[model samples]
Target chain A: MSNLVFLPILIPLLAGAVTLALWRSSRWQKRVSVISTLVYLIASVMLAQTVSEQGHIVLQVGGWQAPFGISLVADFLATIMIVVTAVVAFCAVLYSLVSTPGTHIKFGYFPLLHLLLAGVSGAFLTGDLFNLFVWFEVMLLASFGLLTLGGERAQMEGAIKYVTINLFSSALFLSAIGLLYGSVGTLNMADLAVKLQDVEQQGLVNAIALMFMVSFSIKAGAFPFFFWLPASYHTPIIAVSAVFAGLLTKVGVYALYRMFSLVFTGDIEFTHEILLWVGVLTMLSGVLGAASQFEIRRILSFHIISQIGYMILALAIFTPAAIAGGVFYLFHHIIVKTNLFLIAGLTQMLQGTYELKQMGSLYRQRPWLAALFLIPAMSLAGLPPLSGFFAKFLVIEAGITSQQWIATGVALFVGLLTLYSMIKIWAEAFWKAQPEASGKDISLPLLGVIPVALMAAMTLIIGLYAEPFIQLSQATGEQLLTPATYIQAVLGGQP
Target chain B: MSALMAVAIGILFAASLYMMLRRSIVKLVMGLILLSNAANLVIFTSAGLTSGAPPLLDKVTKEAPVGVADPLAQALILTAIVIAFGVLAFSVVLIHRAHEVVQTDDLDQMKDTDQ
Candidate 1:
């Protein structure tokens, strides 16, 4: 009831305003942004600890009661998501502090990044469905600005597709909300979870659930809706791409996870089967696309879609262990993906380009960078004892547990192909001789390596000490399967 | 009234999809607007088209609040309208910028982003 729940959103929102006010000086902007992100990280970690120790926290804005008032709820899933978001965001700010292009530094990058974080936090914490829409808008607008910050031709071109597809997704999402409201007459998610059970029109409920599935699938960069991802994600600055790669699609996954688990369990067999097929196709298409790409960022972009498939696959299985795998995969993927993108940027910085064909000699010249890159890359490829291995292990175990042979098969196959893709990068960019004309001998500052090293260490730490993360995800999966803890925490005991 | 509105909404949705399917980016933007408007109207019609009395507290408190229109749908529509407007404004500017930079409003010509 007190204000702790709102702190995650407020810290970044206020920091955004402060950064905008100090826009004339990049020095102050950097200091304020980093400090605010640190504060956000602390607040979010404290929130996670609080949620684990004392159960979910719910705060209603304007002191109005739930089912009427807009509320923020930080259950285990939401709090853990907030914590990962803070970590990724802090890394992004740190990365930007070192490598932001001159043109972008004075041009509202810090402010927009702060605003985007605020929106992401808000989306993760909100209890109302409509409030989620509002947060999506917040994220969309800030991302729009960040995407096109430099106003270069390629940036503009990619921004159009990114903004257009996201806007379309929002429209679809709004339409779904409208229809859901017309059917259920409640915008609060917990309230809908309760009311939907009493609604006799199960077929209509299933239809709307499908609408939600498709909408969130697009945001999550799943199959048939992933074109905008590979198109635009490669165009942004590395810092921007790192944040977008890490957070944006996951927000969509979070939404899908919340709705399907909580509000739309009436027709699971039908809707989840749809998700199941989509997940397999998404995985196949993404890895295949990655296999053919020579551009480094584009390949990673496709892999993002591929990894999304694993997450969706976990959700499709829908068992406690399967969902736990999905949650674990999400946690591991965010860290690994964001770090990979950062290392890609660093590679681009060192070689003066992102084309893998034109890049080489990192192994000979800068073994440490290669070493940093190998940890996350191997983890992403599901190497044993790495974070990706355990993430994949849980999901595949869950897939087998559920007897979904084809999906389970595809999940395993994708892990192999992911290693193949990572090895392709290793061979081209690190193992081969430096190309005659392509080597530029560019240098990146030590600060740029700070975030990358930190992420690499975290990946190692998680991989070696996988028990804690697995247990956390298992608890999260339990809360999701029940949904009463969440519903009760948000709606309280007034009934 | 609800039937007519539903018909109009269907028409709008179909037309917008037709526009969106075209290759021109400008049409795509227009299609997005039409699609969103159609969605708003869908919400409007599905909530019922009764011309009802104001939902004052006294009226709402009564057990039989006669002819009181559903205010929630209207509120949702308004919020959607505002959000859609902001999105559309951004889209329009992006289209113009893309046109200026890419020198074409045709989606096919804008393949510089994809590797």
Candidate 2:
């Protein structure tokens, strides 16, 4: 059963390699990509079930011991993340079949996309710090390819900033790993958790934690470190941007969750306090930034940053309930945000532009699309009986219970501002009269609409039936709050 | 030796940051290369400056070796170097392509995406 832990990573890798070999046949590439992601989704569900039944699945690669070799450990948090990733990847690939240009597909877009998934899964599963770094690089390289695949002028401009900032972050991550390894002789996360407790240089450990915080902050698009995200995310194809928006920053948040909960707990006052403020500011700045943007994708890009703040706030609060809320928020946000992007792509297909000013009469032309848009859009704004409402409710409730009044207030304010932006889009893109000069409407493809509708249905399901999901998130939070189980599982009876 | 290496790494980092702050995209790439190299050096220096026998076990005794330099640091640095090299290659090609399409090397001029 432990072997199943590797399936999510392996399936995507093999799919990527096979798709690369089928480069000349875009038809086959599309089939291989979609089938593999479906398989991955199945594997992820199986892994999640296995994890639920048997606390954690730990696989030490090549039969090496934990401290000396890389380990893949899938706790509840990891399993949930893997499942969500597979869901998003499957939807993105399905949407891509009709959305991505044939030229991009011929140029290895599917392969890169699969590789990116592989990297994301690897990062989630790896129990070694350096292995995580390696996975980050893998994801980065594949994303760079995906970003610049079309080589459009705007893409080139965005890619430059994206590439530079990510490269810098990777360097900082590596340096932190080196310094950490210097202080403590192991890179395996479980071993580090054990060793970090005994290291006499507490201040040095705090400093190193800050290094990691900054690096991940950049990756997660926290308040001051988020410029690169908005600059690049909107430049990619909608399918590409959708997956990136859903998975990429969340990976950083995942890392922060893993590290802060497991290893960096020594100086919680010093580190998490900083994170608390960072999260608050990130929420404020992100919402304000979105309120000012008229471009649909750009607005959503800023919203990603803002929502990231909520997750980070949950992590910063660092209670079991808060973590649970963060987990629920993470899952809900991914589906809703990705669905929103897919809907934006549909509008672009119909209106021939992502600019809100150029899009209009969508409500009348395609009422179904408008309704689909409203499902995710209203869910995003935390409307009742929706996934976003429950997600936000849990987080805010956790915040109040934790006595984080300012954060709770800001969160409520951000929700209002979020609604304002959604309404702005509603007014400009869906409700307003059609501009006379806008291009002729292109019919929305069924394939593209399927992913959007499916995801919207998922949002409704999660919202309407919140008990099981909340329980699962609570379980994930318990697992995260208690790292001893993780260490014991990975180390295998060795104290 | 450790102090000297620390100074050298600091200088490398400073130089890279300076290069990266320039307006030219080409120079930014150069800074990235330097930054990665400096990071690799940080790992190398931090792992201690021991000059000892190879970290291998004796064939007969299996564990008789002593005073062996740490092999793990070198392995880590090697991996980092390889990954960095691949990234640098990609960035180089990306910059070349950007120069062709966007028709400017000035980083500040590539603000069209923001608008």
Candidate 3:
């Protein structure tokens, strides 16, 4: 393997160190951070291209082989995730560059954000399950710093709940790893895939699988584990919230797809049913929560959980088309969710608050911002010709194809309620008029508008040119369903 | 020894659950600690009991492949212990900040402002 294999992980980490070590000069910190992220974006794109052409790229660190030392594998799925992560992180940084100025909070948020992205990218690319846990800790720990950056009382309260729940989840995840290792004697995901195939103890495998699901589901904020989300997410600054809303829960979903398809495929009957029901319940609860919320970010947070249900539902179907739809939904949701959160932040910026009741008739003042937000909002509700629509269409079509009538029915109902929730936001924030003296008038810079506009355009573009995405998603899903490609890459072909 | 092991598991389970069920923030923190430690013990016991041997080699004979404890479980348990401690410390500071800033310990007090 080439040395460049490590650059994707190294570049941002080095940048983080430089930023933190040289914190005295804000100018140098900004320059260092921005340059590194741009480099990371380039490296990740190149890595994706390399993987697309050459298949899976594996790097064993410290010259140690797999199953003993950590390995980073850039398979098609991981590469695609990395590329999407780069796009989101790039846009987030661009938005924050404009939004961060003149704020009382220190600029240390940038470095932490970079480290968080590095960790997320690492998690997606790493082939080792233990490495995934470590990367998750890296991201969440950095997030802990970023979430409490402003030192606001509400943010502190929310951060405590956020960190506590995540900590508990991490503990459960570690325990699961211990049990899985004791059972299978290997922690490498690919090696586990092979070893678990021969394991006869169905009950023990199911127990460990459930433990893993509980851990990831908490991160994903599925039903019965979503209490931490609405409590914490709304308290962060708009820029922070937008980026997190777009990325964090998706990490959980990614883990679910990774482990279910890879490590625990033999016992599908037990896991699939639980996931399907969880998906349905999560969707219903999220939409209901969104419908009842008056605060802008809170409603968006609820919708985040609701949208995750769609992805899980697609996975539950376990068909090629359904899994493909799930992949499509994951891609579409990331872009749409991030852009929506950005719009919420932009709204908060313009009106100086996030309460829909306090700030009304926004379209009259900022029609363009309203348009930017409106597109993604409508798309999120699965409006026709938008990315969200295509995503939902594929999932629903898969449901119909698989004869999952109940799931299909639930998805349709959720879509309708989502539409209702979107309209509620539109009506409360844009349709109703507020007096001039009620809210402060604030103007965001043009640079801030560029990232949101770019993402919004990408969302529309995905909806329009969905064939390539769907094809890519299909190929990725095929590779996932058939584990030979992965197994061969991890375990040498001596046997 | 078997009875002691059973009692240990039982006590760990009860204390951890009690801590976890408490509504107070401090108790919640303690609950997580107890729960994680209990989990570590479960991992320890499930791997089998090795009372005779330490992992280190004998110093006097300098023997090769001497009787050593089960290394893998100990390594796994050690990692778990470290992670739990880190999380506990982070939670402690986080809770303190929440208390200082919000001037409240009751999580219910931190409900939605609009409500």
Candidate 4:
């Protein structure tokens, strides 16, 4: 049973290898990629079920003892993340079948996508800090390949900024790990959680914690370190960007939540207070940036940053309900954001541009696409009876309950701003009359709409029936807030 | 010895950040390489440098080691180095490609993507 923890990572890795072997046959590659992702999704669901039933699954590689060998622990939070990752990966691959150009498919796009899935799963499941770094690299390298695969002029430009900033962040992450190992003498997160509490030099531990904070802040696209995201995200193909928008920054948020909740609880007032301001600033800056953008993808890109602010805010609040809100927000945001990007791709497929000025009358031409878009667009704005509404309700409710008036106020204000921008996209792209200079119309590909429709339905389902999802998130929150079970699971009841 | 190595690492980091802030993408890649190397050195030094002794077990006793260098840090550095090398190599090629297409090494000229 413990061995099942490896399946999520192993399946995608094997799939990547198999897809690479079948590279010459694009048709076979697509079939294999889709089938593999389906299998991976099922495995993830099984893992999530097992975790919810049997508690955390801890696997020490090669049968080594916990502290010495690398460990992979799948608690509720991790399994949930893995499950969502597989869902997004499956949708992205399915969408990519008709959407990704032949040139891209021929150039190992499917394999790279699978590799990314492997990296994301590994990042979610790994129980060691250094091991997390390794997974991050795997993810980064694969993303770099995916980002610049076409070597288009814009892609090259965007990839340059993305690559440089991410590499710098990785350097920061590596040095922090070094300092952490130097201080704690263990890279395993559970052991670090145990030993970090015992270290005499609390100041050094705090400093290292700050270092990790800065590193992950950069990765998470928090304010002052998020310029790279908007600059690069719009340059990739929609499928690639959808997967990225769905999974990548969320991974950073997950790390912050995991580390702060489990390991860095010594100086909550200092560290989390800083996170509070960062989250607020991230929200304001990102929404304001989106408000100023006329391009659809750029606006969406900036909104990603703003949405991240909400998740970080939830983490900063540091209560059970707050963390649950963050988890719920993460779950809701990934689905809605990915669906929006895919819908943007569909609009592009119809209108041949991501520029709002050039796109118009989408509703008149394709009412179904507009309707599909509304599900996610409204949910993203926290409209009632939608998934985002509950997500935001929990987050803001937690904030108010925790006496974080200012942060809560900003979250509410950001929700309004989010709606404003979503409406902006709606007005320009769907509601307005078609411009004279817009390109020729291409019919919506059925293949493209399937994933978007399915994901939108998922958002609707999670919205209308929010009980089970909210309960799961709350349970994850409780588990994260109390790391004793996680530690014991990994360390085999050893103190 | 630790103080000297720390100073060296600090210098590497400073130089890298300086180079990274420049407009030339080539310098940016160079700076990244320097930065990753500095990070590797930090990990190597932080593990408490031990000279000459390798971490190994006795053939019979299987637990004879004492005062040996930390093998974990070395393994970590090796992994970091390889990953960094892969990323840097890709960036170098990306820079070369960007140069060919954009026709400028200056990152300022690459702002068309921002629009």
Ranked candidates, highest DockQ first: 2, 4, 1, 3
lDDT for each residue of candidate 1 in A122-180, tens digit (9 for 90 to 100): 99999999899999999999999999987788888788778777877877787788888
- Candidate 3 local lDDT, A1-495, one digit each (tens): 444567677887898888888777776776776688788889988987888887788887887888787788887778887778878888887787777653422557877887888788878878888779888988888788888887787788788778878987887787788778778878899999989989999899999999999999999999989988988888777778887898889999999999998888988889998999999889999999989988889999999999999999988888888888898889888888988888888887777778888877788888888898888988999998888898899899999998889989999999999999888888888878875545455677887899899999998899888889889888888888887788777665723
- After TM-score superposition, the amount by which residue A236's alpha carbon in candidate 3 deviates from its true location, in angstroms, is 1.0
- What's model 4's overall lDDT? 0.93
CA shift of A46, model 1, Å: 0.9
Model 1 docking category: medium
Give the TM-score comparing model 3 with the true structure, all chains together.
0.94
**Candidate order by decreasing lDDT:** 2, 4, 1, 3
lDDT of each: 0.90, 0.94, 0.83, 0.93
**Residue B57's lDDT in candidate 1:** 56
Every candidate's DockQ is 0.70, 0.92, 0.45, 0.87
Q: Highest DockQ among the candidates is held by which one?
A: 2
Model 4 alpha-carbon drift over 4 Å, by segment? A437-441, B58-61
Q: How far off is residue A467 in model 4, in Å?
A: 0.9
Between the candidate structures 1 and 2, which one is better when assessed by lDDT?
A: 2
Span of 10 residues, lowest total lDDT, candidate 2 chain A = A435-444
User: Model 4: what is its DockQ?
Assistant: 0.87
Q: If you assessed candidate 2 against the hidden native complex, which CAPRI class would it receive? A: high
Cα-based lDDT at residue A129, candidate 2: 97
Per-residue lDDT of candidate 4, residues A173-251 (tens digit): 9999999998889999999999988898888988999989988999899988999999999998999999999999999
